[model samples]
Target: MDLPVQQFRSEVEQGMLDSFAALQEALPGAQNEKVAKLRAKAIERYGSLGLPHRRIEAWKYTDLRNRLGEAFPMVRPSGGPIEQSEIEKALGPRIANMDAYRVVIAEGEFRSELSDVQALKKAGAELRSLAETLEHLPDDLEPLLAETGEQRSGFEAARPTGRSGAGPDPIIALNMALMSGGAVLRLGDGISLDKPVHVIHLDGSGEPVGSVTRLIVITGKGASLNLIESYAGLGGRGLQRNALTQLVAGADSHIEHTKIQREEDEAFHLSNWLLTLHENVRYDGFQYTNGGDLARNDVRVFFEGEGAVMNFSAASMLKDRQHSDTTMVVEHLVPHCTSRELYKAVLDDESRGVFQAKVIVARDAQKTDGKQMGQALLLSEGAEFDTKPELEIFADDVVCGHGATSGQIDDDLLFYLEARGIPEPQARALLVQAFVGEALEQIDHEPLRDALTGVTADWLGVKLD
Candidate 1:
């Protein structure tokens, strides 16, 4: 629980604890029972184990205590109607043709004009605001919501420790404590979405604000859906966005989830994505983080049945003094499951990048195939990248391996491109793209991939001829 000796203990950590203590007192007994229970449990855990510091193996590379040394004021939920232009401006040009509607949350409040509730209704999809949905969540979904921090039943074979209790995470606790608005999306059985649904979280130039948003997605058997999430902060200093997404994919269903973060240079961002895949289900994810003072994305995926497949890829373009971390855990619980993960980071100026990936195959999960790779390009003298890729396979018949590489741009490729009359900046940009293009190729949608390419080009400050 003690912070690294180099840095002073976090006062913000204390502030968060105090805030939770106050909230437990202010909230009525029946009104906030669930959250109160979670907070109480978390506090007890914090008292016993404290926050997992950099000493913890799982948090060695990116020291969260250093990032959250202080606390900002919590964002209140009183706001005017949300605007569509705000979403457009934040999304910039990453958005392609979206037949699926959108849900916009501005400073922790839902914006109607930015969402397409009517369209979802017409398609037999259920789209409800978190406030209303939580009041009447279906009985079947209640157990799913329970933060059993413990591993899922099917995944128990992967981690023999049998540690499956979901305790309070400071970051998650911060989100639950301050959450004011969010979205709930559900797809009916056999329904296929014609377009990808986009959710935009935007912050404005106001008092330093702290906000939390939650999203829950459920897919029925044989259904398919594509979901895109974009996060942005407009001219803000010291703003924080803590977001969480929990997805449950049904049998024979397919889901593609993409997250794009381009917040202001001074803002802070933290996000967690937890996904559970059933038999014959497929899950694909692409995450892109381009701007932030301190940003971290944590992803956890579980394979619960036979023939399930999961693929996750990420591309990060960091510059200046920015700091970004991508941490993921993938577990194969059943036989015949497959997973592949590839992450690439491009660092320039004095920025830093972190990638930590772990893949686990259970003893009984024979024929499981899992592969992981993390590669990085340091474009400037001060840029840096740290990677940790690991595989713990208990199954004797499983195929599992992982590798990591970090180095500067390939001089030979740069020279070859320059020899072709490509200028230095353009040549470097092209080579960097070539290095990461393989991951982009995994994207099924051409337009979206092209949009991401454009974003990369812009990040490199090069205009393709």
Candidate 2:
């Protein structure tokens, strides 16, 4: 006799499927046939793949299926009342007063009253809410919503232990299936912004809730922009956030993208950055993560044209029982392109950190240069870190390499600092700051870098001189 096979589904996974079924008719872009089909396809794919787990190679280190116990109710657009002071408090000290064009998303909905729409419009930038854009349904929105099959196949092929039946990334699929409110920014050809455009995401709901947001940015040829994204919670617990941002850089365009994630201690955060670079484009990206109970950052970069340059850096600080994972994949599909990645993590208490990166160079991508490095600092004996760096080069004339390292604070250096006038705590803080400063220094913007440095200092509980 053969026993019947049964597939186990977690509470969170079943809740997500039920929520989608209940909210499908009321979701954004429900009236559009294209978006409807996209959402259907995404949910179907998600049902088959389920939540990513340790069984999946890419998600081996960070298992969402086991970590997320229950799925909170999906957040709706409430247009709730929120004060600018509350926003500042959520952003913390130094970054709250930065000078930039601000866009605020509270409780997963775009808050027009808090955004600097007029200023952005005056600066030759087109801004729209994802909900509004979906309602209107632009002709070019299909490509923005759907991930190409070729890209997924290429990623699977590049993996050492390829996924047998993985169709689309489950995280991305879930985000697309339930995406509601976010901002979309577009810049015209040759247009340049004098100030950065800051997008702030705040979770203010008192009870448990889940939010799905999507941001789309497109830059025209010769255009330049500096974009910053900030995520924080306003005294909320049990918050689940899944956010996706897609950026397309035109030929010869210069784009600087920075992200800071500092959610509440009880929150679960998942974020993805999908970047496409064209010919002669310069793209600089940085991420600072120091919050959330469990957080994962997934980034994928595609070089669609030759002569493109990309630099990506990240810094993560975790303490207590917090867990953070940063995964990146950079593909060079064209010749004469360059890519660099650097990530740093600081773990204290019983916290755990993970870093996984893979760089792939296509067969015809001659003269490609790619390098990746991940470093971790453990402050306590219980702290743990795992790092994996991989390089796949099919081109003969390519220079590609990867490295990873994890260690505790150097005792000699700490003792040397203590021998000076500095106390032990201050000396340790300084060392931690310097350890992460290498990754933070990649940001070219002074104010942004300084503000992020202040954040890092705050995380270390020391005031910077």
Candidate 3:
């Protein structure tokens, strides 16, 4: 006789289910029938799937289920007043004074007082909080939420074959079940913004808590805009953050997107980015990650129409025992599309870094051109880096390739700098900077690029001349 198999549920997993049950009614859009049904389905999916672990190939390196031993209780914003100075200080000098339309989200809730709402409106942009949008659920939201059959089928088909096979993402499911607040921005056809829009995320709760936030951006035909997202903590302890951003670029639109993640060292940060591109669209995206005790960045890009171009790059700096993972999937569903990806990572101390990227070209995507590369620089013997680059093409005419490299800094380069009278530490820092600079240079925005360069230099403990 075979004994019954016992199912094991970690504290974090159990807490998530319990929290959803408790907060379902209080969650945003709880009264809307459609939103209600969506949340119910998401929670059900989460219950069935549980948290990701080593058994899943995508999560093999980062065992989130075991790493996040205990879950922090979900906390609702108190609607308390906050000072602008606090926001400025949290953003630091590099980003605080940037000339951009600023929007502030604190503790998972949008703070209009801290945001440039009036200015944004005057600039002919339609902006609303997720809560406000949910109150009167619109038709466009269903697609952004990944509820459409087409979107779902496309994602399922593109996913790599492994133990995790086509399963719903637990993190995304949990966020959909518990999402309370976020921001949504829409630009009409032919509208062009004079300045970039900066969304500032600040974790300021005094106690340990779990927060979920979402950002949705929709651009109409021929529109052009620059968007920046920055995440920082205000002396928060044990903050568990789950953030997601959905971006839809219309035909002939041009968009430049940048993200900077620098949460507190003790926090757990999980972020997902979903991008959809249409015909004749141009998109450039950059990400810089250097914070959080355990962080994972998940990005998925889909080419919906022909003649679209996408350029993506990222840089990560990890020290101590921090674990950082960057996973991306770019799917070419149509012909005449182009994509390029490059990633750089610097690991110090006993920190570990992981980069997994996959590019898929469908049979009909004949003219698709894609290339991806991931490189890492290890600073110490204990530092670790793992990279997996894959290309799956169903079309023989498509041009697609991928490569990954991991190694320490070149002693010859370091010695060359030191021999020129540079201090040992400074020389090492310069070498590391040059390694990551390749990715940083992909950012077209001068000020933003400069700021990120400063961030990279600071991480190396040396100022660049």
Candidate 4:
């Protein structure tokens, strides 16, 4: 007798199938041959692999196949054109007060009125809507549109994500299939952007919509740029923010990237960064998460040339059943490259936090230095934290090390703080703040660090001096 078998197709799988069909049929880029080809390949690849679960090693800590449900279709542009008043109201005073050129993506569409596109173009920066640029497939933007790195099953799962690494990423393919609106940014050779570029994604409409925003960033040799991005998930049930950022730093170029996530507790946020560094390039990046029911940030970096240096850090303060995951993969493909990774997580109530970091050094990558550390502080009995740090070295001259630690708040420190005339809650908050502040301090920008610290204080129910 034959036994009944269980099916693995979830609502997200089925919904994605329908969503791809809808995008192909109704989206504006339906007629663009390049977009059509990319979308078709993505759809076919996604159909082949499906969603990933804990069975995959890299995603073992945070299982999307089991936890992810309810996938929404491509979000159409809804509501009237956004006025300056609405943009101000959505960005709030903190982001608005920053000295930067703001590029706004509201409801999955690029809002030219709210952005400083013209000013950027006038200043010799190449700024174009991703959807618009893809229409013509300009020669300069060809590198970003093409795929890079080893074959993968999905993301860093199944295997790793470097030369001779893991399987393909379906989420990547999915974004390429239905990505709606984003920006392509390029800095003129030998020029530095006088002001930082603030790309803020704001979703205010209460619709079951998923925004697939893709950004392609290219910095010419000897140029520099400071990029700040955030996801403000303001409204809706089951709101999803799926974003993909591909950045390339030319030789002798510098890039400082900062990200902050302060979404509503009911929203879902997923972000992926694929960045590469050329010879003598410098990259400094940091991320902080305070809100969102389910938040995952995946970053992959490759040092393709010699003399590249990178410092990446992140902090997560989760509370009230919130779940946050930070996964990072760094590959040293050349010689004389150095990378530093630091992550901190504070879990309160029933919240859960995950941090997975891996570093790889190729056989010929001599003088490579890579280090990573992850520390988690659990504030409640029900809170849980998982951390995995790995280092794969093929070069005998390479130096690489990793460490992970998870534990509850220190009673001794709590007592000492309480003895100093602070209340228990306030003392605990102070300790947690200090724990995460260490990671946040690595961010180069002072005001941005302060703004993120303010969010941390808000989560801890304490004020920062």
Candidate 5:
């Protein structure tokens, strides 16, 4: 007689354990000995650590253990390439009109037929599918895939405390075991992408299915590029999405990036972005959300050299018991670097919003300048907002500050708008837009900014002629 398998405490854990066994046996990467070992290590670490919960300070507000109930197995491509009609139905009205070089990921597979890979290559950029690369990973991939810290950045050692695998994040660990395909964009030295590259993820399989999509973007010295990502779930039940984006800015490069999410009302969306910047680099990034029952965005940034600058911003519109969390960590390891972050949210009904940020300055990282702020507008008495801002400084010469605030809509502003012939609903919409627009304006790209503005209009029910 065989002993029975141990039971987990919750449905989510049991599902994860069940899915890991299935993915390890069926996924293509299992055939490769090196990749197989990596996957096994990741799963083992995840098992030991379990789901990030309120007990951990970093994940305190967004309790994955209590909230998630899906086992969300890895998706495999069963049908043919996604058709144009399907893409249209999935993306909705706002992102469809944007002029961008589109890359499509459907049913956990990269759809080359629907992508503009050829145009990107012609413009001196390199693109590849992660699944293809996994079959024959290059030896030099380690340097491109190094951990996220510098010589003096706090927590310079490898992550997960003491895990051995392709990465430290538990979600990324599960992804390593079952990820089907993703996108990779690399720009060589002095190469500049003229048009923005847009990555679109469509989840509309009409059933409960979850998949991991990974995107790696690297810019060589003196290079410049703009990248955008959109995640949408349509006509589906029990849809879960996990995405990981890795960004490396080479010396003297400029990178502008933004992420927009508009998934199904009951879908589960989780994303993580790891960014590393070198000497004299400038990074501008943003995130805007309009959908999801449970959504969390985690971002981490590390400065590798001097004279680097970063401007990070995010905004969310939530209602009807929705939960949205934005978590970020910034590490300064070099001298003369500056980073600024602003987050805003508008909550209605009984929705909840969370903003958690931590900035660490090392003893050797002198002359570092960092500031962070979180602000939220409560549109209803039942809405809830939580914020945590922290700064850890070991250097005597660095300057860092953080602040957070949540309050109801201003009466004076509402009255002023209604007095100017604007109806009560319209006046509320205008005020909400103005409140979130402060952070949206940080993105310098005009067209992208305007496109996001259009999304805000839709959220506010504003009519655009």
Candidate 6:
């Protein structure tokens, strides 16, 4: 069969082709053979599919070609200049008292001084940079990495679309072709770690830089762990970060994920997290996106065993010309599993935000209870919200529902507060915060939840009543 030829013209598609070809040339015969083979397959798939554009359903809300005007090469392995004091200075007050395990990546480069290997080892866990663990990464992970440019499948699934007549996503292909720094943490059976593990990804001033930080966390049966990811950077010039995380929970295990994305105003941030749950396991997550020019969080969860439960919640505050997006998908593959998701967006000035969520229940997955809701507060005439919430159930016995609302603050509530001797601006801010408070209440950690509320208050420039 002969394929059409014009499907290869867009600069985005051409850039991907050139980038992948260069990577293939740079990596010569059989050294890192598996990595090389995966790269080749990804390049072929991308070249045939193109870049993901507005026409693609999954990427309809966020367009990569429009955001990333150009492509950047993966910097060759060179340990460059990085400052430890700068990182310590930028640490937020929430984590100031955290004496827990730490691993830091500066300007896309790993820093040892900021990493706590001893603390990690003492907790019966293993921490190694991706470069050092290259010999140990499993082969199954390679397919997931390579097919990132293509659609995703499995117990949890979502079809990735290519550009307007072009084929798959090249940026994802670029990540697989050039990922150099990441980490893996594995917990022993029945072990519980009270101390949280923090992974920090930082960016600095330079020729607009780009990075892909990958992390794999596996908890043993009956084990429990708490994880905190801090995506921090001194709001600077144009910088881009593409990160991916995979979490696997054993039977009856508990996992908690907390993330802070406070990148600079000109930075471009994109993040994706995929999680798998076994029987009776529980997973909870919280995310705060208060910075960055354009940021998107894509989360996928698969409930493979009966009685598994998952919760995903997040809060985002946007101002200036900043743009933020949070998209999540949950799959119920087995009977008697449950999932609950709540996401809130507060947009001000000329900012824009997007929230797309979907729940999928398989044919045999009877009695699956799933619920999702998204609420947004528009603070300015220029602020915009694009929301799509859907539920696809293949079984009749399942109970699944979803809803989304995008509107301004309630005038009656605002008026009532103002009548109570509060200034109008302060009253409006109070109502917005109260609207978002319900999602924060679900957070189990006191300090983290309070920290997120503080950020929200600061963004609104109001003190809580």
What does the lDDT read for residue 228 in candidate 3?
Answer: 98
For model 2 the local lDDT of residue 454 reads 89
lDDT tens readout by residue for model 6, 63-136: 87677787655544345555655665555665544546788776655566668877777878877676555555
Positional deviation of 142 in candidate 2, in angstroms? 0.6
Off by over 4 Å in 5: 1-9, 143-167
Clashes of 3: 0
Candidate 1 Cα misplacement greater than 4 A, ranges? 1-9, 23-32, 43-50, 94-99, 148-168
lDDT (Cα, tens digit) per residue for candidate 3, span 306-414? 9999999999999999899998878898999999999999999999999999887887889899999999999999999998888778788988889989998788988
lDDT, model 4, position 454: 73
RMSD to native, candidate 6: 3.4
Q: What are the clashing pairs of model 3? A: none
Which residue pairs collide in model 4, if any?
A: 152-166, 152-167, 152-168, 153-167, 153-168, 154-168, 154-169, 155-169, 160-166
Q: What is the lDDT of residue 189 in candidate 2?
A: 95
Clashes of each: 8, 0, 0, 9, 0, 4
The lDDT of model 1 is 0.75
How far is 299's C-alpha from truth in model 1 (Å)? Answer: 0.7
**lDDT per residue (tens digit) for residues 45-101 in model 4:** 666656667766767776777777778766777646666555555555566578888
Query: Candidate 3, which segments miss by more than 4 Å at Cα?
Result: 1-7, 146-165
Which candidate wins on lDDT?
A: 2
- CA error at residue 220 for candidate 5, angstroms: 0.6
Using alpha carbons, what is the TM-score of model 6? 0.89
Worst lDDT run of 10 residues, candidate 6, spans 157-166
Q: Model 5, residue 18: displacement in angstroms?
A: 2.2
lDDT of 2: 0.88
Provide the lDDT at 98 for model 6: 59
lDDT of 4: 0.80
